[model samples]
Target: MNLYAHYVKRIQDFLIALVVSIVLSPVLFTVSVLVKIKLGSPVIFKQKRPGLNNKVFTLYKFRTMTNKKDKNGVLLPDEDRMTSFGEWLRSTSLDELPELFNILNGSLSIVGPRPQLVKDIVFMSKEQRRRHIVRPGLTGLAQVNGRNNINWDEKFEYDLEYIGNITFINDWKIMLKTVLKVFCKEGINTEGLATSEDLGDYLLRLGRITEEEYTAGLEKSKVLINR
Candidate 1:
């Protein structure tokens, strides 16, 4: 790995994330309060995501959905639970502010492949999994390029491309593009979906993976999570 990718990037990510967190403290506080008011307690959403080398790490974000459940005690679909306030938070990318801490703590970078769900990791082919060779990021080449608007195949393509060409210039370029993308409220969701489809679901829907494979992959992901 280059000096920037292997060593310098972590230092830079920590310093920049620290400064950004301090500067955004007020915004973070305000969002926290609003989330509590609108969505109740547990204002922060925590989920296990695959980080560098597929290591499991808790990814944090401002909670954007309610915990309302059905009579069967199942949580409602994301779209069903989404409120206007939550939609606004997602569109403005305010919900992502807490991830700065992940960068600060060395679980992420300012720019790299975005960390994906633990379950998604199970569905990825070996070549697709190459994206995890480096620490994941708050914003990534895939995120800046098309985010949830793009297909899974295209997203992995961008991820691999970014991994193949890691440079300081590239990171800065992606970061600037990310700011613009957020401001423009672009690619926050896939068409006809509350959020991007899971990799396993997308693959199964498209017939890229068989039902047996899908079920097995999901089981494997559960084991990873349990570990």
Candidate 2:
């Protein structure tokens, strides 16, 4: 790791986060109130997400879905329990506002590979595992380019590419393009979900397909989940 580069990145992240948080405080506060009322308790939904080097960090974001369950007390599917407020938050990209703190705290970068649930990280191939070499981001090459509509293979390829060429210029380009994509709501999600294909769910349904097939599917999934 480049020690000076890391520190420079961290300083930039801190400055941006501080400024953005202060500037967006009113919006964040309003969203918080709405989430509390509409989504019930636990206004901020915190979860363990894999960060740089596959380390774990408690990621913070607004609660976008309800905690409804079936008769057996099992949680409902993500698509079923998605609330109107949640959808709004997702469409506007407001749900991710809290992650600014994550960036400021040095747990993440402003731009890199997006973090995944720890369990999701387990299924990654050796090549895909390279994403952990750097701090995960709230947005990245995959995000600005394809988002939820891009397939897994494609997303992983972009991730690896980002890692290979970790230049300030490339990061800035991604940041600029991300703003446009977010405003246009391009590549947001598939027909039902807010992001990405549910590959983990697919594995369950497909049973034990060959490892080769699974790897192929994951690659496709990365792109399909992007915008």
Candidate 3:
């Protein structure tokens, strides 16, 4: 971990998060109500995500899926449980508003690498482990670029690039682009998966569709996600 990187980002994050929390309070309050009414009880979904130094921190997002299960007592996949309203919320990024609280709580920054789950950590290579050196964020270079449209190798490349070249200017650039991406519903998901192509399974099998196949597949997936 870089000492300068830690100190600089911490100070900047504190100030920005404070202001955003203050300004977004009304929107937050309103969304909480809508989530409760339309979504159900426990409007927010809190999950443990790996943060800076591989520490676990609770991540906040609006509940977009139901608790329904099949007769066998197995939960359904995201595609089945995700409601139309949930899809709308995700497309507009309304589902992410609760993360302002995460930013306020010091668990997240407004911009950084998106956090991965505990299970997802097993997928990262040693070289990719450096991403844990900084706090996870709500949006990042990966989010602003191709996001779920890109493969793991490409996403990791963008995440590492963010760590190496982060600055106030870069953060603002990503922020502005994120707003546009949200409106356009870009990089939300590929055709088949609602979230992403689970990198864990892919890496475990060392089985990403092959370089030649992947190049073509990702191009098609990119078009699908942006749509």
Candidate 4:
């Protein structure tokens, strides 16, 4: 019934990603070198994230933090490891440029729900999981709406709305808004944190699920991660 999601949208995503990657190659290269210099080796960070139909795929981004640990050998918190340069990269969203390769490889789209960490997917409610019905996007309705400023529930709602309404117009509108938001540097962070609040914490605080349920979900998620 949905022609765009079934066919045309992917073609559009492929074309747009290809063209954008080529056009932004210089920026990508500059970011890569800077990341190497500022963050040390491994300029690109790769992690498993849930993609289309909740399938796991390797997501890429520019490295923005150091791998420093405490005397106990425990890694430091994100806020501590993140450098001023890293913060700038995040604010400008240059860190996400490497995802062009993900789009090119057909693991992502130009517009859809942002892919989430595989471990986090375990905590997603049934309805929230619906966001993965389509391929993850480089920039999405949630990203343009408020990015990290919004709550996890709001993000899930926006993602579902986009899933239900897929068209050239909506896609382009989201993309345009994303570019504008990026330039304006809107919703770059939640409060003063580097990212939004964790959905697991949100669920737990709302009494939506108990500690036992959370632990069970983590176990289930680990199985998915292995697969």
Candidate 5:
């Protein structure tokens, strides 16, 4: 890989995120107000996610769902907490606006593999673990290709492909495609799902994980998600 592509991309990500955040300040303010009214406090949904080399970082995003829990104290399903306004924000890709800070801070790149939950590491194969060789991105190869519509295996394939072909041109191409995808709202999600299933759940369905392993991973996921 070119030194510029690997080492200097962080500078590019910082500059781009700075400019984008400045330009989008008005929209960010508006969205913050709306989220406060609609989803209540903490307009930003902060979560721990694995970044480059599997290091953990706090990822930021505009909150789009209410924190309503069920009688059992477990959180409600994403579909249930996701209001129409929230869905609109997601469909427009506006909910990701806050992640510019993550890019600017060097926890993420403008283009790479999108970060998954800290607990999601349990589900990765040895090959899938290669996705974290580079910094996570705000928008990535798999993102431009299918977003939440594709399965976990397909996502890892795209991620690994991007890693193998990392270059300035490829990154820019993915960014441009991301813009078009956002405007068209293509692949925002799969049918009847607010988001893709958990990686552990997906592996369980594929029979790649034993029932006990899946349960253990699920517990870990809950702790990570709620932490």
Candidate 6:
């Protein structure tokens, strides 16, 4: 890795994330209150994601869905539980504000590959997994390019492209693009879906992986998460 990727980038990420978080503190507070009222308790949503070197880290975001469930106590589908308020939070990217702390704590950078689910990583090939060589980001090249709108293969291609050519100039370019992307409300979800398809599911749908492989990957991911 270059000096910037190896050393300078972390310092840059920390300083920028710190300043941005402080400047946005009021906005953060207001959002938190609104979320609590709208989404109920636990306004912050936490989930396990794979970070650098496939290490597990807890990713935080503002909760954008209710805990509504079926009569059998099964959680409803994301779309069914989603409300207009939550949709607005997602479209405005306000739901992502809490991730600033992830950056502050060194689990993320301001720019790099976005951290994906533990189950998602289990389905990635060795080359695709190279994106994890660096800390995952708050916003990334893939995020700015097309986010959940693009197919999984395209996302991985963009991620690998970013990794192969990390530079200070490139990071800034991506960050600036990310701001615009958020404002434009671009690529928040795949067409006709409340959430992007999981990698294993996508691969199985395309016949790239068998059902056995998909189930095994999910089981492996569970083990990794427990570890």
lDDT of 3 by residue, 1-227 (tens): 35545677677777877787788889888888987888798999988777888777788998888877899999988888888888888888888888877887888988899996665665567889789888888999999888788878888899999999878788889989998998889988855687776665556447643555545544553443333
User: Clashes per prediction?
Assistant: 0, 26, 0, 0, 0, 0
**TM-score of each model, in listed order:** 0.98, 0.86, 0.84, 0.95, 0.94, 0.98
lDDT tens string, model 1, 19-97? Answer: 9999999999999999999899899999999999889999999999999899999999998999999999999999999
lDDT of each: 0.93, 0.81, 0.79, 0.88, 0.88, 0.93
lDDT of 4 by residue, 1-227 (tens): 28877999888888888898999999999988888888898999988899988889999999988999999999998888989999899889999998989988999998999887786798887888988888999999999889989888889889999988988899999999999999999988887676666667678879998999878877887898889
Runs in model 5 lying further than 4 Å from the true structure: 219-227
* Model 5 error, position 119 (Å): 2.3
Better of 4 and 5 by lDDT: 5
Q: Residue by residue across 1-227, what tens digits does model 2's lDDT show? A: 45534677778778988999999999999999999999998999998777887777889999999999999999998888888879889988999999999998889889989997665665677888899999999899999877878767678889999888877777789999999988998877755555566545445445745667666666754543442
Judged by whole-model lDDT over C-alpha atoms, candidate 6 comes out at: 0.93
Reference-based TM-score, model 5: 0.94
Off by over 4 Å in 4: none
The global Cα lDDT (0 to 1) of model 5 is: 0.88
Cα deviation in Å at residue 203, candidate 6?
Answer: 0.6
Give stretches of model 1 more than 4 Å off. none
- Which residues of candidate 6, in runs, are more than 4 Å off? none
**219, model 6: CA deviation in Å?**
1.4
Better of 1 and 5 by TM-score: 1
- Candidate 2 all-Cα RMSD: 5.8
